[model samples]
Target chain A: MRQFFGWLSLVVLMVFLVIGALFIMRPFGEPPSVMDDYIIDNAQEEAASNNVVAAVLFDYRGFDTLGEATVLFAAVTGALLVLRASHKKEET
Target chain B: MSKIVRTVANQLILFVVIFGLYVIIQGHVTPGGGFQGGAIIASGAVLLIVASGSQEIKTWLRERRLSVVESSGALLFILLAFAGIGTVFFFNFLVGSRLFGGIPSVGPNPGDVWTGGVIPLMNLGVGLKVMAGLSAVVLALALFSGGEELEE
Candidate 1:
C-alpha cells in the first residue's frame, strides 16, 4: 500500500518536472542573448583576450570564479581535516 | 604494478605535464582553460600513484607541500583580482599596458599568447590550485587506505 503511493508520487513529480521544463526552458541554442551578444562583441576589445569565454570567465564574471575557488579550498580543507584526524586518533 | 607499467607511466607524465601547461597557457586563445589543464595534470599524478602506490609517491608529493601550492594559487588569484580595485574590483587593468596588454586585431586572426592581460595569469593560478587540490585529495585517500597518515 505504501509502495503504491510512493510510485504514484514519483510519477506525479516527474510529470510536474517535465511540464515545468517544457514551459520554463527556452529552446536549445536560443538563450536570452542580450548579455551574450554584448559579451561576444565587446569582450575581445575590452578584456584584450582572444578567447571570449576566457575573457568572460576571468574578466567579466570574475566574482563567480572567486566563489568557485573558495568552494574548492573549503572542500579540500575539509577532506584533509577528516583524513588527518584518523592518524591523530591512532597515535593517541 | 609491473616494471613496464611503471616505465610507461613515467614516460607519459612528461608529455602530460607539457600538454597540460600548454592548455593552461593558451587558454586565452584556445578552447581549453585552467580547470581542464589542471585536471590533466592531476591525472598524471593519479597515474604515478596507481603505478607506484601512494607510499612511494609521498616522499616528494607530500600533503603539506600540496596544501602550500593550493594556498599560493588561491592567493595569486585573489591578489590579481584585488590589483584592479583602484578602478573597480576585478577590472582588466592590464588591457593596454606593456605586459600582457596587446589588443589583438578585431575579428578572426591568429591568437597571441601575450594578449590576454590578466586572463592568462588567472589561468595559471587556477591551474595550480586545481592540480594541487586534486592530487592532495587523491594522495590522502590512498594513504588512508594504506594504513598511513599524511606527514604533518
Candidate 2:
C-alpha cells in the first residue's frame, strides 16, 4: 500500500515536470528579432576582436569567463589534493 | 566483440586523430578550431586507453612531463596576449601583414600559414592545455574507479 502511494507520487511529479518543460518550450506569438541585431552591432566595438564569438567570450563577457576558469582550477586543485591526501594516508 | 573488430576500431581511431590534426592546423580559415580539434584528438587517446589498459596510459602520461607541458602552454598563452599590449594595442600584433614595403614589411604574407600573429600559437597553447587537463581528469577518474575495488 505504501509502495503504491510512492509510485503514484512519482508519476504525478513526472507529469508536472513534463508540463513545465512544455511551458518553457512553447513559443510566444512572435519571436524577438531585435536582440540578435543588437548583439551583432555591439559585439565588435566592445570586444575589439576579429572572431565575434571569441570576442564575446573572452573580452565583452570576460568576467564570466574568469569565473568559469576559476571554478575549473578550483575543481582540479581539489581533486589533486584529495588524491594526494588519500595516498599519504595509505603510506602512513 | 572479436579481435578483428577491435583491430578495425583501433585503425579508425588512428584515422580520426590524423583528420583532427588536419582540422586544427587549418582552423584559421576552416570551420573547425583548436578546441574542437583538440577534443577530438584527445578522444583518440581515450580510445587507446579504453582499448589498452590504465597502466599503459599512465606510462604515456608521465606526471612531470604533463605538468611541464601544461604549465609551459599556459605561460605561452599569457606571453602572446601580453605581446598585443606591448605593441601599443593599436592593432592586433599577431595577424599577418603583406610585405608591401621592402625592409619594413618583409614578413610572412597575410593569411599564410605563419600569418594570423598569435592565433597559431594560441591554438598550440589551447591544444596542450586541453590535452593535459583531460588526461589528468581521466587519470583521476581511473584512480577513483580502481580505488573502488578496494572498498568492496
Candidate 3:
C-alpha cells in the first residue's frame, strides 16, 4: 500500500540521517571551537575560581543565570495564580 | 506509603540535605553548582512527600513559608548581583581581598574553599531559591490534586 511505503521510506530516511550524524560527530574530550580554550586559560585569573565551568556560568554568564531565575519565579507565580483562581471559584 | 519506605526516607533525608549543602558551598571549586545542588535537596523533600503523603506533612510543608523562602532567595541573589555595581554588574569584588580572596594555582589542581569571591555566595542564594521554588511547586500541585489518584 502507499501508506506502508510512506512509513518505510520515512524510516529509511531517519536511519540515513542518524548514520550521517554519527559520521560527522565530533570526537570526545576534544573541543570543536576556540572559545573553550580561552575560557579555560583565563577563568581562574579572571574569576578566581578553580572550576572553570562554574566560573563561566556564575561570573562570565551571570546575566543568563539572572534571567533564568526570573523565568523560574514567573513560572511559580503563574502556577500559584492559576491554581488559586480555580480554588476560589470552586469555593464560591 | 509503607513503614519501610517512611523509615528509609527519614534516615536518608539528612544525608541528602547534607550532600546538597556541601555541593552548594563548594560549588565554586567543584563541578556541582547551585541549580544541581538545589535540585538534589528538593529531591530529598520530594522523597519524603511521596512516602508520607503531602496531606500528612502539610503542616511542615507550608506554602506561605516556602514562598517567603523563594522570595528571600531571589532578593539575596539580586542584591548580590547589584553589590558589584560599583565596578560592573557581576564583578568578583572579593578577589585579592583578605576575605574569600585566596587565589588558586593555575591549571588543574584541587580547589580551595576560600576562593571564588561572589560565586559561593551566589550559589547559596540561587540554591535556596531553586530548592524553595521546586519543592513549593510540587507541594502545591500535590495538594491541588488531593494527593491521590481520583476516580473518573
Candidate 4:
C-alpha cells in the first residue's frame, strides 16, 4: 500500500538523520593547546568589555551580533504583525 | 495531583523571582547578568498570570505604572550612553578630568554603584525592554486564549 511505503521512507530518513548527528559529534583527536592559551590571554583587552561573554557576543564578533539582532527583530515583528492581522480578521 | 503540589509550585515561583533579582543586582561581580535575571523575573509575572485570572493580572499591570517605569529606564540608558560620547569616543569618557575644572568629573569610584561606565545603564535598558516586551506578549496571549469577543 502507499501508506506503508510512506511510513517506510520516513523511518529510513530518521535513521539516516541519527547516523549523521552521531558522526558529526564524534571526536577525532585532541585540539592544539596554543590556541586555548592565545584565546584566554587576549580575550579581555580585545573585547573591550568587563563581561567576557558580552565582549565575545557584541565586540569580538560584532557582525555576527548584528545579524542575530536583525533576525530576532524580524521574528518579533513578524509575530506581532501576524497576531494583529488575526485580531483584525476576527473583529470583521 | 492535589492541593499540596499547587501550593508548593506557587512558593517555588516566588523563591525563583527573588533569586533572579539577586542575580541581577550582583551581576557585575557574578556569573549571571541582567538578561538572565530579567528573564527569570519575567517568569514570575508569567506565573502570576497563569495561576491567577487574567482580569486580575491586567488590573495589576495597569495599576502598577509598569509602562512608565519601562520608558524611564530606556530614556536613562540612552542619556548615559550619550554622556560617554559627549566626553570623547573611547577616551575613558566616564572617568576622566573635567574640561572646566568645575568638578573633578572623575567617574564614580571603581566598584561603586555608579561605576562600570555605561554597562549598568545598558543593563537597565535591556531590563526595561525585556520586561515591557514580555508583558506585551503575555497580555496578548491572555487576551487571545480567553476567547473574548474582539472590539474593533
Each prediction's RMSD to truth: 6.1, 10.5, 7.6, 10.5
Candidate number achieving the greatest TM-score relative to the actual structure = 1
Query: What is the Cα-based lDDT of residue A8 in candidate 3?
Result: 100
What is the Å distance of residue B49 in model 3 from its true position? Answer: 0.8
| Docking quality (DockQ) of candidate 4 | 0.06
Candidate 4 Cα RMSD after full superposition onto the native fold (Å)? 10.5
Write candidate 4's Cα lDDT for A1-92 as tens digits.
99999999999999999999998774767564565476456643342334555434433343453354345335544555566668678888
Error of 3 at B127 (Å): 0.2
Report how far off residue B91 is in candidate 3 (Å).
1.0
Q: Give per-model TM-scores.
A: 0.84, 0.60, 0.82, 0.55
lDDT of 1 by residue, B31-115 (tens): 9898899999999999998887788897877988999999999999999999999999999888878977579999889888999
Clashing residue pairs, backbone N/CA/C < 3 A, model 3: none
Q: Rank the candidates by lDDT, best first.
A: 1, 3, 2, 4
B1-152: candidate 3 lDDT, tens digit per residue: 77888899999999999999999999988789899999999999889888888777797678679889999999998898899999999877887668886788887787788899889999999999999988888877777653343222
Candidate whose DockQ is highest: 1
- Spell out the clash pairs found in candidate 1: none
Once superposed on the true structure, which residue ranges of model 3 sit more than 4 Å away at CA? A1-36, B147-152
Model 4 global lDDT (CA atoms, 0 to 1): 0.53
Of models 1 and 4, which has the larger lDDT?
1
Query: All candidates' lDDT scores?
Result: 0.90, 0.56, 0.86, 0.53
True contacts kept of 1: 0.84
